[model samples]
Target chain A: MSARELPLLFIRHAVAEDSHVLGDEARALTPEGRAAFRHHARKLARLTPLRGIITSPLVRAVQTAELLAEAFGVSGVEVHPALLPQRGAHKRIVDLGRERGAGWALVGHNPSLERAAIRALEHELPDKLRKGAALALHPLKNGGFTLAWWATPGKPVKRPGDLR
Target chain B: MSARELPLLFIRHAVAEDSHVLGDEARALTPEGRAAFRHHARKLARLTPLRGIITSPLVRAVQTAELLAEAFGVSGVEVHPALLPQRGAHKRIVDLGRERGAGWALVGHNPSLERAAIRALEHELPDKLRKGAALALHPLKNGGFTLAWWATPGKPVKRPGDLR
Candidate 1:
């Protein structure tokens, strides 16, 4: 948000069922899942200065990504399949991230989401990310990004809210 | 959810603001607004089986309306301004409780929402309503509606893990 700081934020998809049974496309958030996003969004927005959001195309991921995008006032969400857990998906995502550049956010599936976050952090995965969790990182000039602190959804350890 | 309980659910639009400066067509959800809707959707879905959804044609209302419809497998969200909040100088609303003639889920704006909810109860008012609050009315054998419950959106709630 400030010229002094480079922008970056990491966010996970909302709760989703395991694959093979539902097929990602058929999946939709359960009522509780949607609400959880809302709850965390308020907290995320309060803690960070986010520019844009990139997310997976699947419904739950797309919807979850949009929650943070909306909270940050981003114009619209762009789809990136690489953020998916599927193998061989990151190529497109990396390309998309480069084109979009720094100061943006990534909203996507699990492992991929953590991977992208680490890639931004120069290849260091934060502790495991839970659904609806948001990790904010700062891309440093010396190469590799700085850990801006990975915060759980709904409320951060550093920032207090209704949850606390 | 049970055959004996026959429930009706109403979902409120998330954070939205009407600007005197802009025309109605241009108004849309604030970033926080969209988050609010997406946030609560999960919980609302859990409250009932989420059979159907109906909405007003207004853009902001409709956008917020679609999220709920999509989350619940509402199958379709019918747009009808008959449920809309009157524009600029007009402030009257139709009580669809008697007209709609049965239990249904509706998504729309204030006063109108309250009027619709109360019509099933007592059919009068200057009433009090808040953002993202919902109520249900049961249709009696005598063709009157009785108030079931009123629910207010909780700021932070959970997202759906999967549609069960």
Candidate 2:
């Protein structure tokens, strides 16, 4: 594809606060989670210049969008509850995707991510929520999203006797 | 890149407690921060399945790496001062990156990340480092590192205010 027709980034939120420690609406990213978040924030600047940032208003999503916006030198983001994946969430994003032309990221929680990643983009997925994972979705000129790239947070170097 | 060669993930540390609010070393990720971490931790699991974790002994790095270990299903990360950035940090990671041949993730700070990301992997940077950012490096048989992906934590993602 030409640089003119790039892809949209569908990023899963990075790490978040413990579910038990905080309510779904209030949970945030842990300290290490912050590192995990920054790791990617810096990394993204290296790949392609991002467009606009969007995410669920849920604490985790807001946090993710906020940090990303700050990094690429932006003011704020447009929050879309439709990205949340709750009941009736799909209709919101689906309709939005159809109407919107191009260049945007959709940030949200899982089950929705799992559904969108596999069903919409066709990327192989393991489970519902793969925190901090991102799928590049290109809404084709003809309609429908395309899978460009996928990334999960960290990977460990395995040594001898490493428990597989 | 081929299926045979595995890549590694190295993340930048999360934001510490507001510098004015807590001791620099004793700081931790705020409530909002934890949510971001969890979001990404889940994302890491779907990829290569982390084998081991590594980080500095500082409360922040340990805290960040720990969350990821749990999410990735690893017990905990082993620490090495050599990984710490305060004292000749870049040289240490350069040596460490040279020694590494497996899929691994190291949580540390930056500008050390620039050393780790640029020296270990071949990439063209697009922006600056904010609080939480990430970079992915996949080494080639020819000994060059490939910048697989990069991300920032916040809004106005790219230059034009879209998800390019």
Candidate 3:
């Protein structure tokens, strides 16, 4: 695939224990979430090769990133502060992806990940990225990006090879 | 699923003979295109139940819609002028879907279909809708819609059941 076809995978952390059960930042993925996302990540890896994973420092996001690292066979996950569930972290995430020249899976939270995709495509997207959902953004020659596809837990994987 | 979850599936007609081979309006799907799209439609039907198919009057589009009608087990196809590959047809298409309520699959040509989706979501989307690609727009309670998913020929099918 061409460099332009390389994608920035925006992934939302998987299901976690209720915030009331633990402090919000310290919450981690439930056992089921880990297993489900591990399977989903493997399916995703079959579709597109990931160079590495960038994730939030939060436990849930970090755990999600680690699963992706395992699935994609990347050595380690890079924790970034910008991925904190903030309002405007989308810009920094996109910049980080561009700086790395794409093919990176970004493990983060909702709203921000959704916003990053919308901003990149300049169009409205699925309002919510369910826990453990991954949205692919393919770079354009003009510095813009387009929605490549979206994969969520339990959804049948669409193979990109059919397009060839 | 709630009524709001019903989707308006925007499907681009499968590949057709080059416009030069025949008049643009009369162009038909090549044998390969027809066979490929038939398989794609069957996979899509397994994902979402389509109430019916609305198609462009153009031959390629009608053929594509017919396959959807077959896969979906919808009685017939509705050919509409608004899907004629013209500028600003997106509005009419969305109106038709709303008028009939959601759960309809729309088969048409690109640019207009792509624009219709962008207009509905109010965000940039994939710049192109490859032949036989179906984009699902799930309605929101606010009378708007969110992208559910996108399916293209040759991609492994993502099962919505997994989301449950």
TM-score of each: 0.49, 0.44, 0.47
lDDT of 3 by residue, B28-94 (tens): 5666786788789889988878776777755567657756765776654555667777777888877
lDDT of 1 by residue, A61-158 (tens): 65576556556666645454456567755455555555555667777666766666656556655357888887655555554556666677554543
B13-121 in candidate 1: lDDT tens per residue?
6666555133553245666666666666766666665555666544455556556765565544445546557652112223443445443567777656665555545
| Candidate 2 lDDT over residue span B5-32, tens digit each | 6556677766656652224543456546
Give each prediction's DockQ, rounded to 2 decimals: 0.04, 0.02, 0.01
Worst 10 residues of 1 chain B by lDDT: B155-164
Error of 1 at B39 (Å): 18
**Model 2: CAPRI class:** incorrect
Candidate 2: regions farther than 4 A off: A1-4, A20-22, A122-129, A155-164, B1-164
Clashing residue pair totals per candidate (backbone < 3 A): 21, 76, 16
TM-score of chain A of each: 0.78, 0.79, 0.89
Q: Distance from true position, residue A149, model 3, in Å?
A: 1.1
Q: Which ten residues in a row have the lowest lDDT in candidate 1 chain A?
A: A155-164
> RMSD per prediction, one decimal?
12.5, 17.9, 22.6
